[model samples]
Target: MTSSPSQRLAWPDVAKGISILGVVLLHITLTVPESKDTWLAAFNVWLDPLRLPLFFLVSGFFAQKVFRFSFAELFTRRLWYFLVPYVVWMLVEQQTKRVEYHWVFGDPVFDFSQMTASLLVGHSMAWFLHSLILFNLFLWCVRKLPGWAALALSFSPILFIAWQAQFTSIAKAIMFLPVFVAAACFRDAISAFASAIEAPFKGEWDYRSFWAYSGMVGAYAIGFFIRRTWDSYAGAVEVTWLLPGTEALVRDDVHILVRMVEQFFEVPVGIAVAVAVSYIPVLSTGLRFIGSHTLPIYLGHPIGLTVLYGYPMALNPREVSLAGQWPLENTWFWLSMCFVYCAIASLVLWALGKVPVVGWTLKPPPIGASRRTTEPPSAGLSLSQKLTETRNATTRK
Candidate 1:
C-alpha cells in the first residue's frame, strides 16, 4: 500500500533525540558523584527503567522499512555505515582509554569483535546499532508476510526472557526481534493514532495529543524510575525479572504487566504534557527544531556528550574532583539545555552532510543501479539471413 509522508513517520528524529537524551541521562546517572544524595539518586533510579527500552522501541518502529532491501545490499550498506565509523572511533577510543581492549590469541587485539557484535544484538548503547541491523534484516524478511505471521515472529520476546537466564547472547537476540517486529506490525495503529491527534476532537481531549504527551512523559518517568530502582535493588530486580523457570517467569510476567500498566498511564501523562507544550507556539517550534535534527543528533550526540562528560574531567586536573558539578543543576534546566545543544549539533552535522565526503555516510545508499537500454537494429531480418549478414560483415571487417 502507498504511504503518505505522515505515514513515513517524521517523529523518529524526535524519538531519536529522546533516545540520545536518555543515553546521556544514563551516563550522567552512572558517573555523577552528587548522585549519592538521596533525591538525585531516586531520580536516576527511575530514569534507568525506560531509558534503553525507549531506544529499542524507537528502533523497532523504524525497522519495518529496512526489510525491503536485498540481503547483500542491506549488509554492505548498513554494515559499512556503522562499521567504518565504529572502527575508526574505537581505535581513537583506545587513545583516550574510552574503550576496553582485550587479548585475543597471543596478541593484544583491539576488540572490534565486540563492537561488531554490539551492532547486531542490543549491547548497551552499542545495542542500538546492533538491534538496528538485526531489526532491519528481520523486518525485510517478514515485511511482505501476513501481519499475524509478523506478530508471531515478534512475540519471541517471551522466549528471550526465559533464555536470558541461561544464554545471554541468545536471549538478547531473541528479545530484540519482538520489539523490532512490534514497530512494524503496529505501524498502522501508530499512524492512525498520530492522525487522530492532528485533528481536533470534541472538547479538549484529543487522542493523538494524549498519546504523544504520554509517550514523552512516560519516557522520562520510566527513565528516572528504572535508574533509581536499579540502584536501590542493587540491579537485582532486573536480573530476577529476566530469569527463566515457570515461577520466575510467572512472577516476572506479573511485574511486567504491572509495569506496562504504569507505563500506560505514565506515557499518556507524558504525551499529554507534550501536547500542551506543542500547543504553545514557542515550545512547539522548538520541539520541531529538535525533532527535525534528531537523526544527526542521534549519530553525533555520542561525540558531543563524550566531550561534555569525558574530556572536562580528564584534561583539567582539578575539574575531576569538581566534576560532580551538574550540567544545569536541575532536570528542567539540564533537559532544556540538552535539547538546545543537541539541536544545534544536529544542525551543524546536517550542514556538514552536504559536503561530498560526509553526505555519503549520513544517508542510506540507493537500492539499485539505473538500467541501461540499447535500441534494437533499425532494420529487421530473418534469423538465418541476419546471421549470414553479420558473418559476412565480420569477414569484410
Candidate 2:
C-alpha cells in the first residue's frame, strides 16, 4: 500500500529526509565559498560511505513490488515517474553547467559525447532520480534469480567499478546496488527486524529489546570507524588490507572497493540512527514531512544551486575557512546556510509550480490522476489510487 500522511513509516522517511538534507549540505559546502573549510563539509564528505547506501536500501524496500509488474507496466508506471523528472531537470542543470564551465575555464564546455553519456547515466544532482529508475529495472530483470544469488550477482557491477569508478551517475548506482537489491529481496525479514526493533517501545519486551539497544550501539561504533576510514581513504591515504592474510585485493589503484565496502557496512549505521531519531517525536515529525516531499526537493534544489554557485566556481576564486575557533561554531553557521539555500530553492519551486505550463514540469500530474474527471483535480488521490499509479514510487508526499 502507498503511504498516507497518517500511515507513513517513520524511520524510512526520516532516513530519506536526512539523506536528502545531507545531499543539499554537501552541495552547499561544495559551492559556497564561506563553508569550504568548515567542519560541515568534512562531515558531509565523511558521510559519503553511508548516505547513498542507506537511501537505496530504503528505496528498495518500498520498491519491492517492481518485480511483480509486467514489462510495459514497469516502464509506464514505475520507471516513467523517475525518468521524467530526471530528464526534465537535466536540461536545467546542463544549461547552467555549460555557462558556468565557460565562465571558469574560458571555453565552451565538454564534448557532446560526454554530455550524452551523462545524460544516459546521469550527472549532477538529479543522479538519484536516475538511480530510482535503474534500480527498479535491474531488480525486475533479475527477479527470477534466487534471492541469495541475485544479491551475490548485484556485486558483480563492482568488477567494472574496481578498475574504474564510473565518471557519471552510473558510479553511485553501481556502487549501491547490492544494498538496494538486498532490501528489495528481503523485505519480509527486514520488516520483521524493524518490528523487533520497535518491540521494546511497544512493551513486548524480549530478545528484540536487547537487540534494539545493543545493535544500535554497535551500529554507531561501526559507523564511526567506517566514516574515519572513508575520510582517510578519500584524503589519499592507502587503506590497510580488508581481507585478512591477503594483500592481493587492496591497492592504491582500487580504492573504490574500499569505499564500496564502507558504504555497505554503513547501511546498518544509517538505519540505526534513523530508528533512534524515530523515537524523538518532534524530529521524526519534521523529518517525515521532508521525506514525503523528496522528489521536488531532490530535483529542484540543484537548479537553484547550479545558478547560484556555478559562476562563482567557474571563476575559481580563493576560498577561505569560515571555520570558527569556538566549538561547533562553524557547524552551526554552515547548518544555517544550508537551510537558507534549501529554503530559497523550495521557495522558487513553490512559485514556479504555480505558473501555468512551467509548474507541470516540476510536478507532473501523478500518473492516472487525470482519469478521474468528476472529482476536483486538486482533491488528490486516495492512498490506494496513488499506490496503483505510483507503485514504482512510494507516497507522492
Candidate 3:
C-alpha cells in the first residue's frame, strides 16, 4: 500500500524508538547494582543530555496533534494511559525492594507512611512519569493562548529570571514543553530547513543523511552533557552558600534561570538530533519499530526488572554479575545485559498485548487511519464526469 503524508512523516516514530532505547540504557545504567562504580558513573554521567528532554519533545509533538481536544479528553488520555500506570508502578515499586532497601545494600528503610508520601512526591524512576503528567497538564491549560503567548507562558522560567532574579527548582522538568510546542508550531519552517540542508549534497553527502547521523550523535552528546552537568549542578546547589536565610526564600527563582538555560539550549539540540535521525532510512526503520512498541516496552520492562531479573540479581548479584560479565574487561557487559533483559521483558509484554481479546487496549492508531480522504476518479467514469471534476479541481486547487 502507498504511504500517506502522515506515514512519510515517520521521523517522530524513529526518534521515539531510539529515545526509549536510550531511556532503557539510562535506567539500566542507574540500576545496575554496581552503578556506584566510577566507570559506570562516568558512563551514566555522559548519558544525561537527551534523556528527559527527548521524551518531552516527543510528547509535545504528539500532544500538538491532539491539541484541539477538550480539557476533559486531554486529562483522561494522560490520566488513564500515563498517570494510572505511573501510580500503579509507584505502588509496585514501594512494595518491593526496588526503591528502598537495606542500608548496607543501598536500600532505604521502608515505612508505609513514607511510602504513601512517596506516591504523591514520586520516588526513584517514578518521578519522570509524575513530571511528565504535570508538564502535559500545564501545557493543556495554556495551549489555547496565542502561539507566542503560550510559548512565553510556557517559558515562564526565563521570564521569572528577569522578574525575580533567581531560578525556580521546578523549571527544569517543565521548561522543555515550550521548546516542544515551538517545534510543533514551526514544523513547516523546520521541515523546510531539513529540506534546504538536504538539497546541496549527493548520496551520503546529501543533507538528509548527514544531518540525520549528525543529529543522532549530537542528541546523544547533549544527553551525556545534561547527565554530567545537571548532576554536578544539583550536588553543588544542594550544599551551596546561596541558599541560606532569604536566599532559601529566593531559591525557586534561581532554579528557573538554570532550567531556562538548560532547556532552551539543550532540549532543542536533542530534538533536532532526534528529527535528523528519523530521516535516515535504516535508522528510521529501526526507530519506528521501537517507537511503535514504546508503550509495551515501557510498561513491561519494569516487570522484568521487578520480578524476573531484579529479585534474582538481588539474591545472587555476584552470580548474575558474573553472567553479566561475559564481555571480559568491559563495563558495558553489565549495561548490555540490562538492555537485553529489558528488551526480552518488553517483547513478552508486547506478545501479551497482542492476545486476541486484550490487544485492543494498547494498540496505537491503526495504519488504515493514515489513508487519504479524497478518492481518485474512476477510470470507467464518463469523460463529462472527468471534465466536471477537472473544472472543480481547477477552482479549488
In model 2, the worst 10-residue window by lDDT is 369-378
Instruction: TM-score for candidate 1, please give it.
Output: 0.59
Q: For model 2, how does the per-residue alpha-carbon lDDT over 1-397 read when each residue is reduced to its tens digit? A: 1234446678899888888888777777776556656677778876776667777889998887677777876876677767776777776777677777777766566567766777786766777877778788889989989899989888776544433434544456557888899999998877666766667665677886677567756765775676566556544444444543333434533556556666776677677677768888999889888877777777767776666545544465433345653323344543465567676876777677788878777666545532334544224778887667666455555
Q: Which parts of model 1 have CA positions greater than 4 angstroms off?
A: 1-13, 36-59, 62-124, 157-177, 197-277, 315-352, 364-397
Error of 2 at 378 (Å): 25
Q: Specify the highest-TM-score model's number.
A: 2
At residue 160, give the lDDT of candidate 3. Answer: 30
lDDT, candidate 1, 1-397, per-residue tens: 1144324343444444444556655554445444445364466545533444445555666555455556765666445465544444433334333422121122344456754554444443333454455557667778788877986876555555554544344544453455456656786765555444544432445666676555656665764475345335532233344444543554334344344434433432332333344455665565546655544655555554444444553444232223334543444334344445545655666777778866755654343321224234523567887788789879999
Error of 2 at 205 (Å): 2.3
Task: Give the residue spans of candidate 2 off by over 4 A.
Answer: 1-6, 34-36, 109-114, 212-253, 312-320, 323-338, 350-357, 365-397
For each predicted model, how many residue pairs clash, with residues at least 3 apart or on different chains? 31, 2, 22
lDDT of 1: 0.50
